[model samples]
Target: MKTKITLLMFALLCVSTLANAQKKQKALSFISGKISIAKYHEREELNRMNKGELLDLYIERIEVIVNILPNIAFATNSNVTMSTLGIPDTKENRKALVENKEASDVYFENTIEFQKKILPYSDTSDLIAAILFYESTLKSLHTYNDFKSN
Candidate 1:
């Protein structure tokens, strides 16, 4: 009787652990998909700018606007995940957030500088529109994923 009870408890523990692991995997997949969508949008925006298709004035403002949304999303997501994992969302505690902020700032600055240099050669409105579209798409994807997760 004692041996049977021990075996049942162990089996139950294993099943619970497996279920938790599966849940974690699902959450991770959702997070990965969100990150990938952001990256793809950023790359597409850069490609359009590099093609000299954006106008000077629009490129100048749009580049900054386009980069800001993704930066905010990344920061928000990082903080939320850290909190969910019961980790402190501090600069000293979260190295990934620190690194992400540094890299994103540099990228944002560089994109602006690059845009200024090429503004005279591209169509500003078109560049702005393209960036806006990408951002909107990213927002939609995030919303859909959030709903799906819930």
Candidate 2:
């Protein structure tokens, strides 16, 4: 009887751990999808967003780009920032919004304006991934005009 109970408990633990891992993986995938989608948002779609929403989308794009920078330390620091934005408050799943919108309004507006001046290019390009070429080729094409103009 004791052996059977122990086996059952162990099996249950394994199943629960697997479920948690799948949940985490799904969350990461969701984050990645958001980043990908933000990069390709059409001008009309972006224009539809209120200033706050647009700012939030712009910040999300910048944060992911920063995470993959050359410096290892930058990647680590950006991971923490990404987690803060992506992860829900520990208390409950219902209240998941991590951003303090009111507190960030001033910074968001200024940052968006500054970014536009610096980048000065539309991020909404129709050139998505090409199956025949390398991924970098697609990336190059996407930013080619911007680099040339600069």
Candidate 3:
């Protein structure tokens, strides 16, 4: 009876741990998907900017800046800026900017003061990765838009 009780407790513990792990995995997946979608929008904005879409340029620039603002914030130790105006500092605000939307009147403005501090230590590969991320983001955004419009 003692041995059986011990085994049962062990099993319960294992199950609990597994359940927590699964929950964590789901959260990570959700965050990753959000980030991927944001990256996609930024890439599309970049392409649009390159195609001489002047009107879109302002918004696209904001989107790219917003998409990369987190990394920039970490790198530069500055506040994260928004791509839109009048948006509050919340996860929803960030999501909106990353997803499909136009300009926001309120932006979380931050100075790019850290550029000079970190640019010297930046790696060529990192730059390449950034480009790749932008491209991927663009592809994903286009695909999503096509799916939605169709």
Best-performing candidate as measured by lDDT: 1
Q: Model 3: clashing residue pairs?
A: 39-137, 40-137, 44-138, 84-104, 85-104, 85-105, 85-106, 86-105, 86-106
* Model 2 TM-score, 2 decimals: 0.26
Best by TM-score: 1
Query: Which regions of candidate 2 fall more than 4 Å away from where they truly are?
Result: 1-39, 71-150
lDDT of 3 by residue, 1-150 (tens): 999999999999999999987662211111111222233334444443432232223334344545443443222212324422333546675565445322221232222234334544545444444655555654544344354443
Candidate 2 local lDDT, 32-144, one digit each (tens):
11113224554566556565455455555544433232222212232333344565524343223223322244454676578667543434332111111223332453454
Better candidate by TM-score, 2 or 3? 3
Q: For every model shown, what is its TM-score relative to the native structure?
A: 0.40, 0.26, 0.28
| Candidate 1 runs further than 4 Å off | 1-81, 88-93, 138-142
The order by descending TM-score is 1, 3, 2
TM-score of 1: 0.40
Worst 10 residues of 3 by lDDT: 25-34
- What overall lDDT goes with each candidate model? 0.52, 0.42, 0.41
Candidate 1: residue pairs that collide:
54-122, 54-123, 54-124, 55-123, 55-124
Count of backbone clashes, every candidate in sequence: 5, 0, 9
- RMSD in Å for all candidates: 15.1, 14.1, 17.1
Candidate order (lDDT): 1, 2, 3
